[model samples]
Target: MASYHRVLEVFDRSVQDKTLECAYDLDPWDILIDDERWTGKIRLFGFVDIFFLICYSGEERFEKGIIIYKDNDSVRIILERARKNTTEYVVNRDALENEEIPKSYFSFEDDKGGLNYQILGLGHPIGLSTNYDPGSLKQYKIKIRRSDDLVTRKRMQRGLKQHTLIDLMLDVVRLGIITSAELISKVVTMTVAGSATDDLARKYLQVLSGGQPGTPGLSRDRM
Candidate 1:
């Protein structure tokens, strides 16, 4: 498996201004992390997760904490634990409901799904470009199947044994980097909790295209 390090792209003020990514396959860095944790939840509709982190702020060089984007009610335990490490921090959500969810929670927008990664943005971060998103005819079936395949794919890769491919995809979209089959494949393989499986990737692409593999015209093999 390939290893890569990414910066934390904070689109909202709710999150800290530090770069937050996985620690595996990372090169030695000057940044010092005081605390870090990862937790995930599986649901019928979709998955939910929390990553409570605290670190020495690179800008000021002092201890600071970070809160998950979840509602303060849902992340009370994590926030408490994280606070044990630092007094000053950015809690994405705390014991407040009416409180505005920091725009940091989401990234920029994408016309493809009409979903924003951060929140407000002019256009999609990673351009859909000339390529096409598997149309609606196959979107539902493909997303469900693809989401599952993603879970399996993350399991095969090393060091990425915690988050799902969707996490990587979200991060990429937030970063506004290029998103291609090769790029997505390489990065997802590096960060997910499982090993990379070409067969699984193909299965998802095929389903997305609404066509079976080994058939011509529906899907292309390369990015």
Candidate 2:
């Protein structure tokens, strides 16, 4: 199993600069491994949303999305694998249904008469306050408001970077414990041999608890 101390030492070395910019403390190691909440959730979705008129929703394209693998080391491995698997989203009409979109927030009235009788998109009756199924448009309003915040985007971006870091950490953990311990040892430690055979099997549990590195490819367990 990879030890926390072992990986932390390596991470500290990689992010040796101590100031990661986005970090309020300006410390490179501000990214904490002991965070009780999973930072991955924030990265799974973008901070700001774009609202659009009924005109268009763009063409079909491959987009990045998130998928959870496991709560531990395997989650990291699967996330790493997924970075290569961009998802396909179709731009069909149904795709534009009521969901809050990116960068297209505005009231789009269809000008049938080009006057007071102009129709709202998808038969939304004219109203002072939104009294729709979403109820007061509270969620959409919040999404738009939150998305507009600069700090919100910063948090989202940082969360994404860490998400990928966690993935690489998972792969390193798996290699050092499950798939190719011998391979990783070549880079970090061949001197990492177990004192007892019983110690070798117990290594995986330790790796499972491993977290993201402060620097890109550094590991909590070093290699």
Candidate 3:
């Protein structure tokens, strides 16, 4: 499994000064995820932040955090953990000229019939390409599978786990019974617990898990 840090990096870049400042900021701009069909202004329906509580060992670690962006039609997932930067970071280059550096990815389905979609980043920094090479930005495509619901095409599986988390968090928000943080803490703390070498990570996890140092750590079942 890929490290969540890569996903976080994409989101951190996407939310720069030009990008979304908060969930409400998502509606002002029409996101083009390599698609020309769904051009209408998309609204932010859901947003979730997954932190060190869900992190596990033996996976790539990132520093910042992870976030989920759910719009009117689709959801974008990005994660962050602790890891080294060995790969080239995409910058102010023409996205069309450069191949898409898919650092991290996630997908979502609407309530109706669960239409599957694979969203690709058209520009660097995940989002906030308004000032960047808009003309040169890569085309964001939504790969649609009408018949299949849970089954996804190639490279679509990595996003499955993230999507599940997004769905759960969205439901929690809808229910208004518990906050996403409390719910994740209770669920993850019960399933996994380990050590965090990073000072900040440990402290952050402790806060989420109610100041329990060993409450939250990293562990992916398959990885």
Prediction RMSDs, each to the true structure: 21.8, 21.3, 18.4
Q: How would you encode candidate 2's per-residue C-alpha lDDT over 81-167 as one tens digit per residue?
A: 223111121112343564554211122222234221111111111111111221111111111111234684455333223223344
Off by over 4 Å in 2: 1-73, 76-146, 160-223
Regions more than 4 Å wrong, model 1: 1-162, 187-223
Query: Could you give candidate 1's per-residue lDDT for residues 149-216 as a string of tens digits?
Result: 44433322211112345755665565555565457666656547434333323321121222434322
- Model 2's alpha-carbon lDDT is 0.24
TM-score of each: 0.18, 0.16, 0.20
Give candidate 3's TM-score: 0.20
All models: lDDT? 0.26, 0.24, 0.29
Worst 10 residues of 1 by lDDT: 136-145
Candidate 1 lands at a TM-score of 0.18
For 115-155, candidate 3 gives per-residue lDDT tens digits of 44444322222221112221221223433342232432222
Candidate 3: count the clashes. 20
- If ranked by lDDT, best first, what sequence of candidates would result? 3, 1, 2
